[model samples]
Target: MSDATAPQPFNKEIPTDEEGKFRGYAKARADFLHVRLVVAACGALIIYIPHSWHFALITVIAVCLAEALDTISLNQSIKRLNSGAPLRPELRFSLYTAAFQALLFSGVVIGGAILQPRVTIDMFLICYLFAAVMNAGMLLYFNSAATYLRLLIYGITMILIISMRWMYFAGAPVLAYETAATLLLAYIAFRVIDFVENNFREQEQDKVNALSRQKSMKTQLEVYANKERHLLQLAAVAKHANDSVIVFDKTGRITWVNDAFTEITEYPRDEAIGRRAGTILNGPMTSPETVAKIEHAAATHSPLRIEIQYYTKSGDPIWVETNLVPLPSSPEMDGGMIAIERNITNSKLRQSELANAMRNAERSERAKSEFLATTSHEIRTPMNSIVGLTDLLSEHDLDPAAREYVVALQDSAQSLVRIVNDILDLSKLEAGKLKITPSVFEPGHFFNKLDNLMRPRAEAKGLSLSIDLPDDLPLLYADEGRIRQILVNLIDNAIKFTRSGGVTVAVQGARIANTCRFSVDVTDSGIGISESGMRRLFGYYAQAEDTTSQKYGGTGLGLAISRHLAREMGGDLTAVSHEGQGSCFSLFLPIACTDQSLEGIEEVTQIPEAPTANLAERTILVAEDNATNRMLMSKFLEKCGAEIVFAEDGQQAVDLFCAKQPDLILMDMQMPIFDGVEATSRIRALDAPQPYIVALTANAQKDDRDRCLKSGMDDFLTKPVRKVELLDTIYKVLADRPMMEKPLS
Candidate 1:
């Protein structure tokens, strides 16, 4: 918490008057010396006045007694001032000293009157008045205020003395002396009055200046009070806030802490206060770099924002964001820092989760791309042999049993193509690159399509497949392609996993909401997922069981893609299953409301079938780098009754084509001398009849195909060639050639 008290002023030296007790003693001794000198001067003046020896002696004794008493009072006053007590003792002593001196003077006057009976009383009276005036002046010198009061008191004494003098000397020669003495005394009184008046005026002006300064200070203090109140309110709010707040001095001491700080650090304010901030809060896990940064900020008076790991009171490490600021007003004062710490442990954990998600996404993408490339190569390799051999077999008269076996082979090949295309579609959907094309269609038609697609697979698995569509179901305005993809993936997963149970897809609800939800539940009696497996069931490439790779074969991306698509369509896909029990997968889709009549949904056309015929009369050239692939192509093509010529690389193929004039060339990419792309370019540049060129390369990436096309190849073919794709491509290229230059003739 922020400190509430204002800093004390910096004092360098002590005042001389308040230095020590000994100074007070020195002051008292100085006053005593002055009083003694005054006494001696009075004695000398009395001796010159021609008084009797006894009178003079008595006068000396009186003066001596007065001085002694005054000295004692002064000493007492100094002692009281030094002791730091009230001025009562000093004032009382001063008053007593004044009284004593007054009595002494009165005695002198009375004694003179009694001893000098021959001497007119007027002379004695004049001498007494003079002594009174002198005493009053001495009183004024001793203490200013006391002196003024004494002067007034003694002025009345002088008046009484004058009255006595006038009565006694009215018929005596001493009247002249009395008159002179009275004039001088009156003048002295006048002077004392003038001096006192001036002194009083000076003191009054000093009082006015003092009051002015005090009033200005009061105004400033009022402003300060308002500001302090505001700051106090702010401090209270900061102290009560949920975030832990701590203030540290420039020396790194924990000067203040809020309630929240105590709650977080588990250290009470009393225990934390005056302790070093680092010693209490820092632990082994705390970074040295963070500590260095805090020190740098304090030393340089810079504000800093940093995130650090700090141990809580329970010794648990928690992440905190600390905002440190410097107080710049007082460099000499301690506690110049404001530290506010907020718990960010949850946020850090969330950030970690997101980072892991991104990494997983990247890995999934790489896997999909790899799968596509590998599958392309795998499907096409055998396809070339099948299609080529089938063409060769078509040329011969074959038994009916042989024909049936060939047909089966063709069916299996087509199935593989369909599976590859499905995988590709799922990959596109997962990548968010699949486009949606919405159309008005009957919900029944959608179900029928699903029935047709999955009925065969279900029959193969010896499982029943059913669909439930309410007659009242309205037309759904949704992307037919996406909806079909979702159904296909879910039903396929059900069929693949279920050994005996049937798969059911049900559709319901077409009300005022202008939408319909189709629930596709595929229940299987096969092995169900475990609780731990369910956690990652919807994750990409995560199978339902640990041995899924051995027991069931799948890309594991089906459910993941289905869920993503379902969500994109403003619906969701969920699953419920238990170990050893059947699993139910449901897909919910929002119905589309439209006034138009539902029409039959169109399906994409299947690949055209190739005519079975032998190309033995035609001559073909094989250009390949890999020896195994080259031999495979040679054997397969020769079995079709075609005369075959081989080239180890692209450059050889180009040279052989110019000499042999073969009907076609199967080019391989990644060769030792020259690759397929270069060979194709060189072949097209030749003056001779350009052989029907087809790229048969392992570089199956999309960019690779574009490059092959740009090189003037008639067609692009990925490696591990399929029999059907190779033959179909050959026929297409040959069909487009000019008949006048037909090499087979």
Candidate 2:
């Protein structure tokens, strides 16, 4: 292996044992001093030995040599440790000291045995054991080898003392026995000393740990004190803040108010205290709901923010956005509420201005709709008269040129009506008032109707029309009229644009979740659209080109209207085209399939038209405010075999209806005094039998129709109604319901 890849040496190990006890230079030096101290103290006991002076001098010399040797060894080890060098001290120093000390202890006992044997042996045992217990265990207990060697030397010296007393010194057997018993006592004392040293070490560790915990607790207390001081500072800031701050007591009574409160409310803090917040601040502009919300938030221990109106001491109203903060109950402080209120009078004024502007915009929109409806009515009323008169003139014999002129007039009038209808329809769509009413119908019949309607136009343009429907297609659930209208617009556009070739409409279906998605692709071989022309093709009032618009003479709204209608039915309309190949438009609709067994699908059965009733027997009331409209209606009904009675206003209509008691009443809305709704309501509330009431109004909005129906009118019809529709509604209402089971609507 290369040197770069070789393993590195580890860092030096700590000078500590498994019990985490430190045996470094400082501890070793302390041990050295302690050993010397024990030696000097033992020398003082030499007076008790036989030949006290000699024994004392010899013990001092031995102690001095032992202390010098221990000091030299400890100093050498400390130098090695300080210089960061590995220590290799000789163990002979410890071995020699233990042996020399043991021998000195033996000599003292032996000298006593050789002279006054009984007394000195016992005194010597007492002094030696005491010195061993105090210093021997502590000095070298961490060094196992030295500790064991010292213990061995003590045991051997005890055996030697026994021999010297009894076997060799002509001493009593009791002295030998006393020496042996003293050895046993010394062993037991060492055992006790060992236990005491361990206890001391444990006490030292516990003291360190206790000091660490105390320091940590002191730091935490200091941090808590700092935080408490910060809170006091914050309270001082709040007391002098510029925003009004009111403190409510447990009973919802104001207990305190900041300087800002006095400045804003024009009331001194002392006077504001002890008063209810609502009683002090609430005025004509204050809302009960906002007050209730504050009380509710306090009771529930939640916070509430509201824009509140308050009157000052000068009785001038001001708006404020107030936050009610609920305080939690605790032993140190009673529970209450703190309301921090910021003035928002200018903001409230700006909001009022915005609200007024929105109201004006709404009024403008309503006025626009009214104007459109009224204008449409005025135009259509005369247009209806012209169309009806033209129809009557067509039946008379005339020259070919005059008849052609009349036909042209009829077509032009019809075109104008269609334009008006489109404008109204677009308006309704933009206003989101056009609602889709869904019903179940057979797909085969639905497509068949479109096929029949487009076939003649397609053939007239020298193009073939064909439809391809899947055999397994089920009955569909959607707005039948809307789907039919969208398809008609698509198919008519296809026929109108294509002059040659053919148009093919293919119906394909696939199951999409619970519903089936049907795509009707209408491909036409016509003048294909360019890329730029296709970009805005489906936009409102957009056509393929200026030339196309000039030549075709159309509103260019068909595709745009068709696409929106398709989306409102939960689908979309898409188109794909090539420059020369032709254009294909696809209408996709996702409609649910109906269960055939349930027979819930509505059948397209035609209602038979009711026959005109006898005019001699029937009496009708025509309540129209417009003179021309009233005259036009009277003539139309007079021809339909009914006696017509006219009312100029709603009040007049009500009076005529009650006086004549007509079989039916045709009422117009937006009249003087009472409107159609009030008139109808009054007629229905009469004690007599209620006659059939039908609304004939220039107000063409759905809201108008809904109001008419809600006011007890049986039927509603927009103004400028066709002669056939008017006659039909009249015949149907007057016809006997019991004879027909249900009158045709």
| Model 1 lDDT, full chain set | 0.67
Instruction: Note the clash tally of each candidate.
Output: 17, 1
Give all TM-scores, in the order shown: 0.38, 0.60
Give the range of the ten consecutive residues with the poorest summed lDDT in model 1: 1-10
What does candidate 1's lDDT look like per residue over 1-745, in tens digits? Answer: 0000111111122112222322332243344445554654354345325666655765766656665666566666677776796665566666666666555655555455544444655454555455555544532322444445555555665566555555655677666676777878778856864675455445555656777789999988998998899889989889899888888876778888899888777889999999977787789989999999988988888999998887777888788899998876655565478889888889999999999998998898788787786676566555645655554565567898887666556545544554565566566665666666777776666677678868877886689988887888776677877778777777777777787878777666656666565565666676778999899999876787779967776657767877887888788989999988878888777767766644333332233466556665576788876565666676556556667888987778887887778777888766768788888888888787767777787555655678888998777776445656676676666555552244342
lDDT of the candidates, in the order given: 0.67, 0.71
280-356 per-residue lDDT for model 2 (tens digits): 88899799898888889888878888888999999999999999998878998799999999988888899999999
Q: Whole-model lDDT for model 2 versus the true structure?
A: 0.71
For candidate 2, which ten residues in a row score worst on lDDT? Answer: 1-10
TM-score of 1: 0.38
Which residue ranges in model 2 land beyond 4 Å of their true spot? 1-212, 215-222, 225-345, 383-418, 452-464, 496-503, 525-530, 537-561, 578-582, 596-675, 696-698, 718-736, 739-745
**Local lDDT at 69 for model 1:** 66
